[model samples]
Target chain A: MHDERMISFMFDTNLTKHLAELSKINFTDDEIAVISNEMSEIISLMDTVTEYNIDETFASADPVQFSDLRKDEIKDSFPREEILKNAKGKSDTCFKVPKVV
Target chain B: MNDLLKCTVKELSNKLNKKQISAVELTDAYLKRINEVDGKVNSYITVCNEQARISAEKAQKIIDAGSANALTGIPMSIKDNICTKDIRTTCASKMLEDFNPIYNATVINRLNDNNIVMLGKTNMDEFAMGGSSQTSFFGGVKNPYNTECVTGGSSGGSAASVAANLCAASLGSDTGGSVRQPAAFCGVTGLKPTYGAVSRYGLIAFASSLDQIGPVARSAEDCGIILSAIAGRDENDGTIKNIDKADYCSKIGMSMKGIRIGIPKEFFGDGIDSEVRQAVMNAAKEYEKMGCILEEVTMPSLKYAVASYYLISSAEAASNLSRFDGIKYGYRSENGNTYEEIIKNTRHEGFGAEVKRRIMLGNYALSSGYYDAYYNKAVKIRGKIKAEYDEIFKTCDCILTPTAPSVAYKIGALENDPVKMYSADICTVTVNIAGLPAISTPCGYSSNNMPIGMSIVGNSLREATIIAVADAFEKQFETKEASI
Candidate 1:
């Protein structure tokens, strides 16, 4: 059990950019380099979790019973105007966004 | 400092009930204190002066009719992340700089029922991400004890306000030591209630599984008073437990004789500062004098708690924050032709560096190829951590340790090293990972005059016992007042 091989992850600017794209956040080349360096430190920190091979199943700390959930009955919600009050671009009763082809 | 401002919530409640002070006068005193001290403290993002005055007037009317509760006329600060109806709740980000919620959070509604006077929304780390509160778009919050030092965050302003007497008490959310660490650094009391003890209906979720609303106040009893007002099951929040609300302050001043308190040896190793360790040990001696028994115990999984915590929290944060695209209620970029471009541009412009970093890390951890190594492993380790804690609680009534590795340092001390900043949270994150109730109260001050805190952790849903232990210590402890 002590002679286990751990998967090595290669972190670089390309990987950082790929992650940023997946996250839907943009970053400059210089910013990506910085983030790449920072993420390496964080990844090394997280490697401790992989160092131990625990033989246990994952259980939630606070498990919610299915029956304990609130009843799925019809209820009053916020009005359209109240919900849309904070929108930057709003039409008559709905939020407006740029045209997506 | 005004004597009225120095009164704790219980003392002020008694004074209000006895007609010795009117609610308006108490509110004005706090508002005046904020006006004089907040410039240097930078604790508040928005001071609701007119709204506070109006609420105070109404509260006074309720008191006149002899229907006031402990918090009825108490002026308190709300962290910026909590939604307040008709008031701007920014989460200290540019994305929600001008966005005002049309509905109050369930906690806000509960507090309103008690006739709570809203002083203002306090500053915090942007989206409750950073530890120093420096990532806030508004500005960083300074320690009231020393303006150059940081108020440990992401609930920095909430603790700083209570320490500086800007308000009687304040509410702060704890994802991973946000409330307790800041309370430790700022020399006040903070309580992180058991998971599902308080509702999270309108809290801006960083990690839904770890976040719980707690109180930052000058005394543990004051925290209990606030907790009683806010804790209970709510239909709006599904995560809350369906249990009767217990009086958290009911056991204060209880005897500590023969209580078995566990001192985990892993928490006091080489990483802890010597002075901080000494202060906590001194606090243990005090408890010993109070007839409590100290037992040395060990928990091996505490070494991996930070890694497990960050992996899970950041992953949840990534998913929760995806809803803030250009289409909804947050900030929208001005220049983007297509919908996809618009969403990307808005996120790029709206989020701070720390928030973006977490998003990137979250995506990396949850990627298809790495999920088993990172996120899944973290969940398994989380289970192990909970198991280790359960073993200790079988014999120990409560656990004792330092709230932070060290006292607060100067701002920008760990700015360039994010790993170092994250590592400092080791002392406080384990309790959150295990979903237990804990309280951080001032134990002693450092040689440099900075305050140190010690935590008393109880079993899940055992808030009253821990609060009782903390209140007992605070009864004889000499707390230093910040001369802001």
Candidate 2:
């Protein structure tokens, strides 16, 4: 826990390229280094939770109960114009896309 | 009445009934306090003064006519994660920094139904990830006591606001001690009820299976009262059932004669600071004097709690956050080629680094090759953890441990280490993983006078018994006072 290099261990970039690809956000190596540094601090602060004597009495994930989530029934639908007003990009009566379309 | 703003809901309700203080005046007083102190704490993200004034005006009429609800005009703050219809529901992240929910969360609806004076929304960790409240896009919340030490988080702002008397009681979401841990840092009582005891209809998803909303207040009684109003079944939250809610304030000052409490040996070992452990031991002795019997219990599988919790929570967080494609209300990059392009651009631009890390970890854990070993194995181990708790419950009514290994550290204590920060949840995450009830009540203070909490847990849906044990313990301790 006392190693000075432990601080640098957080920015290992082990997951950087992979995560960037998945999340679609590209990160400069400097940005990755910064994120890793901050992450290391957060991880160290949370080290306390790992010390518990959970003694096999751990619980499972919460179970799903009866959800009133209704089927996708469109009621009182808003006009496309109103909804698209807040959209970053839109096309003729629908959302616009880049050349890939 | 300067004292009116400090009174608990129980006290305020009694005074309101006796006409010693009017609800409208009480509401105005808290609004004034928020105005005076909000700048220092950065606790509130929004102030619903218009709705508060309107609610207070109506409460005055009800009181004048001699008919009003118990919580009428009682000021309460809410976490930023809960939606309030057109009000900013930032989750303290720049991602949805300006996105507004089209509807209110059921808990918000329930509180409104009780006529609670909406004080405003409190800040939290960005997307409820960070523990020190440092991750908020709005800025970090300072501890009311010193402003140098952190107010433990992701619910840090709610705990700080309540500790500082900016509001009577505030509601916070606890995925894993989010409410209770912060309560300890700020010297307040926080309850994370049994997973399904309170509805999660409006809470923004972190790990949907783990998040539960609860109350943070100055006393166990206050937490109970707020819990009573906020508990019960909600059709909107399908995961919740039609369970009966007990009168939370009904059992206060009650005898703890036959209650059997188990003290887990693992919580008090070498890593816990001496002062923090001493505070908990002192609390245990105090509980012993309160006519309850204490027994030693051990759950050996808990050593892996941190490893198990991270695998599952991070995995779930990744899946839940997948819905935030830039196509929606959140930040979206201008890049759009294929459908995949929009997702990558939006997520890359919208989510911060920590979030991206978790999402990638989750995607990998749940990925084809790693699913069985990482995710499935963790789930199986989770069952073992649950089994151990189940075995112990057969012998005792509840369990007790330190809410955190120690008191709040400086702002940057673990800012460089994500895993270390995640480990802080080790002592508290078991209860969340188990889907049980737990509370963090102020037990004692550190040499520096920072608050320490005693975590009390009980069986599934056993809110009544859990609060009863905590109530008995809280009543006997005088150091339970908040530093502010």
Candidate 3:
């Protein structure tokens, strides 16, 4: 099942660093080195999926049918205090965070 | 009363109903066992001693009123990820270390309606990200069989709690064999209901498409009892389909005659340990002895299972876990001057290494340039896997395979090697991908006495059939107790 064409994706420390940035995570140089090596190995292992030449016609992702879902009934929400209880910075009804600007 | 710890859920229910033991006494017995040995096992992140005793008192009242059911007054641990109304549902991560849900998960509500006593929140891999429980911030859960080894995770604590008699049974979440693998490692029974069988209204999602809440217990019947109580149509979760079988134990003790057990040759390949392979094969022979037919089947897509599973799961996880920003009801960092900085810093500080790695993988897979090569291809492979399982089930009643490639390894052995750790999930991930019901029960033990588990994978919503098959094997299986 191993195919030469499956080995096209390139993974390296640079890619790992970029992905971490996209993921909103900050890793140290040492951590990046370790994670890069691990990610390269994992991605290589995952490359097996590329071997299958599945017809895309059969794979138009099955959308969850609306009929399968239950009727969305209006219900009382959790109390404001309860909702805000676990937030680190919270006012009476809202979670407080740093200024976006 | 201490001997009562050895009883199954049904046996204990009988004792409680017969007035041989009060709910309080049974709860206390399990609580005492937990208090004594949990230091060594580290199975629990939080033990609800005071609340458990209080709930046990309430259960006694229900029993006195003659309104008790099978799980009434039964003490069981809940996985830390499942939301409980007032209990700290930590998810074994610093992110939600003290976050308490103001509402009970649908399953918790169902169990509560049955008057089941909650023991506490059991530990797990941080955000259920890793295969081994060592990634937990609260410290890893040690195997009850051998404390030096890992209890296969991310339901490791739940399985260990059941194996060590910390509780009569426990609830766990399975995403890529989390519940079954840990149960196998700890010598217990675990069931991963079809994706939509159990409601996921309040299960903290790891991979939304693959995640399922299940039971870990002493026997298949015990898991059945728990599943029956917890599973049903829930208006809160849109994914739950109306299942016909309300009682999973309804077909227990049925004859295995004429049952076609499928043995997929791909599952027992060079990757599987010889001992685990032999043990599962021995289990097939046991089924054959019970007059069941054994047929060698094929799942050609099995080789790509692990890869497909990781890609899809991580993609969903990236989306599901993005909600845990600093503004939310979880851990926050004080080091940031701006909103983005706060969110990024909080995540870096809160999540463990494995969780971060998965998030990175997920981001990489879903990123614009790689979406077609990774996530989309994974979804197609998933469809192919489900189709293959459908064809196999057309010819077989159930597919049997080793729950994991091998028995539990020593702690820290596979944690550093991401590929090795992910490869171990090859045998079990397809069931989740197909949304099938499967049970992992202790079949045989390794030469060094570690437990080996064999899984019976049934078609979608065939939970009762698989449970019955597991119960049949469990009745004759001489399972060893963990020497906690």
TM-score for all models, in order of appearance: 0.98, 0.89, 0.97
Candidates 1 and 2: which is better by lDDT?
Answer: 1
Highest TM-score scorer: 1
Give the candidate order by descending lDDT: 1, 3, 2
Fraction of true contacts retained by every candidate, in order, equals 0.68, 0.33, 0.61
Clashes of 2: 42
Candidate 2, residues B67-148, lDDT tens digits: the string is 7767776889999999887677889887887777777898888888777888788998888876788778888888887787
Model 2 regions more than 4 Å off: A1-15, A32-86, A90-100, B334-342, B479-484
The models' CA-based lDDT, in order, is 0.90, 0.78, 0.89
Candidate 3 error regions (>4 Å): A1-9, A61-67
Sliding window of 10 residues with minimal summed lDDT for model 2 chain B: B475-484
lDDT of 3 by residue, B1-484 (tens): 3788988999999999999999999988998888889999999999999999999999999999999999999999999999998889989999998898889999999999999999999999999987789999999999989999999999999999999988999999999999999999999999999888888999999998888999999999999999998887887877787765488988998889999999999999999999999999998999999999999999998998899999999998988889988686888988878888888888889899888888988998898877887889989888888888888999999999999999999998998888889989988899998888999999999988899999999998889999999999998999998877
For each candidate, give the interface RMSD after superposing the true interface residues on Cα. 2.2, 5.3, 2.2
Provide per-model DockQ scores. 0.62, 0.26, 0.57
The sequence of per-residue lDDT tens digits that candidate 1 reaches over residues B270-327 is 9999999999999999999999999999999888899889998899999999998967
Position B427, candidate 1: lDDT? 86
